[model samples]
Target: MVDTDSVTGTAKELAGKVRGAVGDLIGSDRDSVEGRARQVQGTAERAYGEGKDALRETADRVADAGADARDNAGRYYARAEESVRNAADEAYHFAEDAYDDGGRYLSEGRRAIAQQVEESPLAALLIAGAVGLGIGLLINTRR
Candidate 1:
């Protein structure tokens, strides 16, 4: 409509102008008035068609922008999900390592205590009695 209709309307206007000029040259008042009316009508129709075409183009651009924004949002959401999963995996591995280290430390502490007790049975027995007395006192206070 923008291209074809505009061109047709322009052609009509030009033709009307030429006819009006010719009528004026020949002194035909009726033909001159008719030609001037055609020129005015053609101009109005051309403007209307051009306005419609401009509105259509604007609507298309807006739709395309909306689609592009939606696509970008989807990609960003996927990236955020992947990042969360990766962080969780890293945290799990870290916790596993810490648990293994704690187990090793506990084993070493038990062995050390056993060796000390073997080297000094009497001293270990006295220490154990003292620890038991301290625990009994704490329990009595809570009660």
Candidate 2:
């Protein structure tokens, strides 16, 4: 839409042209100069109006860009948050699985040790005594 000033300026310019033409027909120097001056004023007002329109358009574009950027940032933040939560859930499941595996392995190892000790009680007792002696010697050395 054309600015109000632009429309007004156009009307003024048309009037100025008519006035200037009449002055020329009547040979009036003062009217001729006045008409020319009015034309200049009209041109200037039109330019000012056009400039204001351009500035308003530019501001609107900038505002749209800002809103778009904000929306994009919000979407990115939401995606990032979802990714972190997913990773945390994966880690929790992985840790739970590892704990379960460790407990199963520990139970199997205990059962194996019990079986071995039962099969050779004397040998297990001898090995335990040797380990205790070695630990005692190590403690004395450290002290």
Candidate 3:
């Protein structure tokens, strides 16, 4: 009962077809001609309404597609942001592990050097002298 033009026209067209048939059966030329004219008018009106409906449907679909694209873009951005955050966390943890390893190595090296110096003071002194001599020679060459 929305009374869309297409529905109204379709009803009229059916009525016209029935009237035309009845007129033909009863041998009334005037009634038959009028019914055929009405049928043609109804068909034109129905076609016009159908064209409008098609255009409206196409517009609605276009709007929906635009909305869907925007939503998909938002989802993609969120996923990319999450990926970046996860990668940063992984990189930070990796750097922290490396820092800890470096600290441990430095501590071990210090302990080893202290032990060596305590075990042999004379050898430690000799090694220190050799290092100083080497540095002096390098500097003299640069000069």
* Per-residue lDDT over 4-73 for candidate 2, one digit per residue giving the tens place of the 0 to 100 score: 8777867777777877788788976556555655665566556556655655555555666788765665
RMSD, each candidate, Å? 39.9, 39.2, 39.4
Question: Candidate 3 regions off by >4 Å?
Answer: 1-65
Top candidate on lDDT is: 2
> How high is the lDDT of residue 120 in model 2?
100
Candidate 1: residue pairs that collide: none
Alpha carbon lDDT of each predicted model: 0.64, 0.67, 0.66
Clashes of each: 0, 0, 0
Candidate of highest TM-score: 3
Write the residue-wise lDDT of candidate 3 on 31-123 in tens digits.
Answer: 565566566556655654565565455544566678876566556555654554565455445545554665677689889999999999999
Clash pairs, model 3 backbone: none
Worst 10-residue stretch by lDDT in candidate 3? 83-92
Compute the lDDT of residue 79 as modeled in candidate 2.
Answer: 60
